[model samples]
Target: MMPLATVAALSAALLALMAQASVIGDDGRQTADREALPLASIGSLLDLDSGALCTASIVADDLLLTPAHCALRAATDADCAWPRTRSDCREPGALSLRDLRFVPADDHQIAPADKFAHSRRIDRVVAHGAASADYRQQRHNDWALLQLAEPLAVQRHPPLRVAVPDYATIGGTALAMPGYSADRYYRDGNPVADVACTLGFVAAPVSLIEHDCDSTAGASGSPILIRDGDGGWSLIGLHSDGPDPRYARSRNGEHRNYGTPSSAFWPALMQLQRQRSLQPPQATDSRR
Candidate 1:
């Protein structure tokens, strides 16, 4: 008995609601409300070469944690020039540090008028010794550290503390994964997040932790966080890769994400923090 015009309008509204619900069931929400504080520590890593972007977390005033592959030329090619030693990777022009920018709390604003006071150029990059040119090695040594040209003012954007949750404690625990995903496609480049993911399991040999968090290409170094009882969040790992295509479809039909456990790189992080603390303050750049 409804008029034709009214019926059409109601159908459109119903379709819109269904579309929104589908997105929610697929990738989770944008996570702005539940993770505002922790979001401040997350950012985007822009590779000038291929125009590729990845996620990263600020763990210290001058240090960032991300995946090793983000800094490599051909990360998955085993035949590519791999940094076999510390000296090889640290030498001047050994690895590409030029044109690499870290934008903390990046909301993906590309407008000329947008304020980007928190973005900084990378001064140095260090990957774990185990990281190699082979794709197979990725799961084992996917971690990397990025040192900024100058320390970010911690008062404005606080750094996250890395922690390795006990294996028993992590099983069935809820986690939040925040990142700047390529598919999110915001005109302003705002980061998206999955706030209700869970740690499915851990692969001890490769030090890989698997989770049900929804992620995409640009989320390579996104942080996996666990909330504490005292209302604080701790960094547990850095997202590295998604499940194999064959095995992926079976796990909730969403990508099964993986990350390198924070405990694997705790010693290196501590050493870097100590060295950073010992360094004298340098002049601040006004152009940044």
Candidate 2:
């Protein structure tokens, strides 16, 4: 679970972001060029059993990063016992180590409509927690590293580099969060991105961040990015939810999006590098 302190700080940031929402409105939202760097590095996850859709990003040639909760697969078999709400079930399982496929899609098409293109099978899902009776309990550990059945070709699918939070420059670089948000997802497959968003101020040991970025169900597990000095983008976190159980509301009774801090997941990603699952991005792919 997310620490209370982190939740409080994010909530505070939410209050500040709301104050600027009027001015930030439609200006912060933009359509991403799908063939570009960051958007090019992202794709969609299809839960075969449930036919659910979620966003995922390539962190390495053979690995994808996303929210673990996105793996929740509800059982409706006769062996299943149901004594609670629709969300709760006995022996609730997950899509981990299952047949979840990652499918790359063109910006103009709905994700499920183009499942055959560049689709890769997921062989494993390494996560801090799994989908269970309660999802909120695993919100802090919402991230998962998915190992693809085969590596993506370097020239065609370069991975996005992870960027950790710099304590010394917390108020620095402008942020952007591009994802396939559910609300406008059907209108056009083009993903909606909240570019040049603000983070206000964050507190240390920050496990989560709150922002005014526009998002919905499909946007979960989308990458929160920071513009680098070289006119490129690096990942700062994975967008999780808006005013979830941890930080339900701000002082002004407003809700903002929450993201799992990338800095907290850096070591785990590096471990994958040590395992040789992560490959170097080509210079041209860097958009330098």
Candidate 3:
């Protein structure tokens, strides 16, 4: 006995509600699978001596990218402080390579008989000169690159390519953030991920990319990735910090996380690559 027009209106309203719910749900976080490609490229950046953990990504055969603060131990190092300018931030002795270790795709699943083929010791650490040692310009100068003592055996897990696309191009694109979080350590005993994250804002003035991704202490230096049309993912930004209090909270009062875009330090990375090419050949770890 219901009228056709009334039923049609009700149906349309229901559809609208469902669509709105979908959009809101999309902004929420979700964990990625253990076998995800992006997850395979990330590992824990550990302090060899102290066992302090942070996240890092394998961007090249022997190059790993992470936040400078993670390497400098900025939170506790008295010598570490932000510089007034980029030149002042390029001070040496701020980090020691001998104290670092890069464990790629490590989920702590290795058995006693198995060797950690993907783990590499730090040969050298090179942070962005523009990255301030202080919090004044932390957002802009938060990136660093670690040269592994030996190249990762590509057969295990190939390194990801850093993407230096313009901000406008990937402003609103979805991003996947995978890292070794402390919560996971206490709960699942492995690094968890939010594969359905998206770029929240591109604050160019501060040189930081904000994203709606779930991250924590150990998640620093995690890579923010975007999928290419070819079904491959590229490293777009380095997840350097957790949600900023300045930004308005989203669904669960989760403020946006921030990172240094790859474009910001592409030139320095290229220069480092060129410099490495000219260095004399040394013994490589061929375990893998």
Candidate 4:
């Protein structure tokens, strides 16, 4: 058997690889190398796909942090938030209620045996008080918090820790994400149908860097994660949007993408924490 230190080092390297992402499958599924990753890598795959295709990070045992735009479900005629037609209350490009679900990392793409098969619904979405205003003024600052109806069992998987201004250090670190796309299965050449994970870089604060990390419409909110010491993970950013073909071709057909950095706004996150704390305990069901 390998020495304990050697084994530990090997494990760390494998975990780091998973932190980098793969391409999305055509069916909006992922082809993750499960055997190479730790349970924690699996924990990061919480499916918080509310209406707008976005990604999220598990900040706490039961809480997830994501973009407000992703969870801001557009009110429809069937479920009107205002009397003046559900369409009136909606923004230009908003997601409807039918396109959202929260599946744990392990059960997200490839369903586990029996205990983890189907994706679960998000119990409630807690958008920051100023999310709408901030999103309008600065699209990159749009962020929110989510309360999973059932607490995930990530005690075994090293959970991610929230960071503030340290995002600048992300430049050279490795990153990854497994996300869904328009097509539900994996495909080659087609950006829309591939669900994959690839190695990426945490650029300054604006764009999370990557050479092969091409993303499409369905990957708007994919979590960009980086591994720290002791297998700990930190969310560097999320896949926001990709560069235009003109921009890419102009720059020698290079692949470049951007994400809303977590460091960009702290008030939004704090607001989420406060809201989560104030929620009535009885209103939720524990999934311990």
Candidate 5:
């Protein structure tokens, strides 16, 4: 679940729609480019398919970051019940990561059409060591990590850099992302790959950015990107949701998007790294 601020924003949007009777997408509403790279380099957007598909992104070479709720969402399956809604299941291992799998998409039919050209799966997922029982309800700390089975190799795609958890903002900057999603309302259709601009201000400590970036059910874990000083883009946040539900609006209005601020990312990264070392994998793949 999202935090109060996010819920408030969504509620407000819903209210506005009701008053206007002007559906967001149907009436008006709605709304990443990727370099050609090896399947390994197609690093953004990890696919976790339980019943519905969700998206995630790589924050560190070994650490793939995503909303903690996603872990709960995927666990709803009969075979994998992490008990997201219950307080008792909030403990470590409560939301199991052992059964998770990653599958890279080489076509937009798999995810975003124009943003990512290729993708590959991680060997396994490990909970971020610092994850807490309270994370399920806190909203702010909604993040997790996945350790890839192998490092990616690609002709174009490259690893993204993590920003230190500091009070930094890239106001009015150009940002892009690559993700997998299907129109929320149309649940039974193919997922599409897409891209859009991130336009907004930072709400520090909880840096928030507004963008018209289009996303759907499958795009839960896309990376938010801003160009860095060296002309490379550093990951700033993970793709989450907007004001409207999948069916309420079309690609235009409902596509208005928001994400968890990068401020929280640094801590999550450190925690994930430490967890990986303590429970080291037996091997790693470096295939092209």
Candidate 6:
């Protein structure tokens, strides 16, 4: 964990790009080992064709959560906004299941040929707000859910518990964020984790959480976690790039990262589970 005092000591190099950074003060991220329970729950969401990647974590036996933007078509300079719907903004069934994959515990710096064996296919995507051109305008509503083709093995990697009652008590609490940041990432894949960071604030008006953890592009859908009573970790928020474009100017006087609170997504998740219960059973791939 980087000292809290370092956050205010800005350098000339960082001052120029303060508003565009995901890291504050100095880089405090380190490579993490996913050989155990909680850490093993972290994985990478990949677009098999374009090779784009975003960090994700398992939240249920067969369900994982990621940023809604990760499910959209890649942005273009000509993408629409506001009054005009963004040209590539997503609609239901807009994604290709064949190309969308969730690779479990993708911490191998050099991947093995058995990559496909552990990779899971996304069978359904339930997004809250990625259907408009102005998707970037509301970064707080940027979460999405992905249902896997089959349930994950419980012994090696268990789904993380959402921080519900604990979230109400997170004032000034320390946090940890682990994900697949793209900057130093190589072909085989390695996850970087920022520990002992704290949230800047939890704004009730926007249902958003602001933090000082260091992360990057591939870490967009990473989980902002807190320690639980049982000495385990729980998910509290979903990390996004930063803030909406219009709100970027007001930084509260520090380099802060933004995310949607679980309060905003928990209800929708309950609904998704109910819907899934009614659906007929489907066949799953048996490669792995």
User: For candidate 3, which ten residues in a row score worst on lDDT?
Assistant: 15-24
Q: Local error of candidate 3 at 46, Å?
A: 1.1
Error of 4 at 269 (Å): 2.8
Mind giving the per-residue lDDT tens digits that candidate 4 earns over 122-232?
666555323334322233555566667677766643456655655445333455554544333222211121223344444433333342444544555566656667675
> What is residue 98's positional error in candidate 4, in angstroms?
5.4
The estimated TM-scores of all candidates read 0.73, 0.69, 0.70, 0.57, 0.57, 0.73
Candidate lDDT values, in order: 0.66, 0.63, 0.64, 0.47, 0.48, 0.67
Residues 5-46 of candidate 5: C-alpha lDDT, one tens digit per residue: 343345334433333221123322122233421123233343
Compute the lDDT of residue 184 as modeled in candidate 4. Answer: 31
Compute the lDDT of residue 137 as modeled in candidate 3: 57
Candidate 1 at 147: error in angstroms?
A: 0.7
**Candidate 3 vs 5: which has more TM-score:** 3
Looking at candidate 5, the ten consecutive residues that score lowest on lDDT are 22-31
Q: Judging by lDDT against the true structure, name the best candidate.
A: 6
**CA error at residue 7 for candidate 1, angstroms:** 46
| Candidate 6 Cα outliers beyond 4 Å, as residue runs | 1-20, 33-37, 74-98, 106-118, 130-137, 243-246, 249-252, 274-288
Q: Cα deviation in Å at residue 4, candidate 3?
A: 72
Q: Which stretches of candidate 4 lie over 4 Å from their true place?
A: 1-30, 35-54, 81-99, 108-117, 128-139, 156-158, 170-172, 181-212, 229-231, 246-253, 274-288
Error of 6 at 167 (Å): 1.9
Which lDDT tens digits does candidate 1 get at residues 1-288? 444335324433443333322132466747455345577787888664445667889888888888877765532223234553343444443444434678777444564123234457888775453645555346657878888899988986689978844634456688888887665523346777788888865554345677777776677888888877677888888888775543332355555667778776787888877886899999999999
Model 3 ranges with Cα > 4 A deviation: 1-31, 74-98, 111-119, 131-136, 167-170, 186-188, 244-254, 277-288
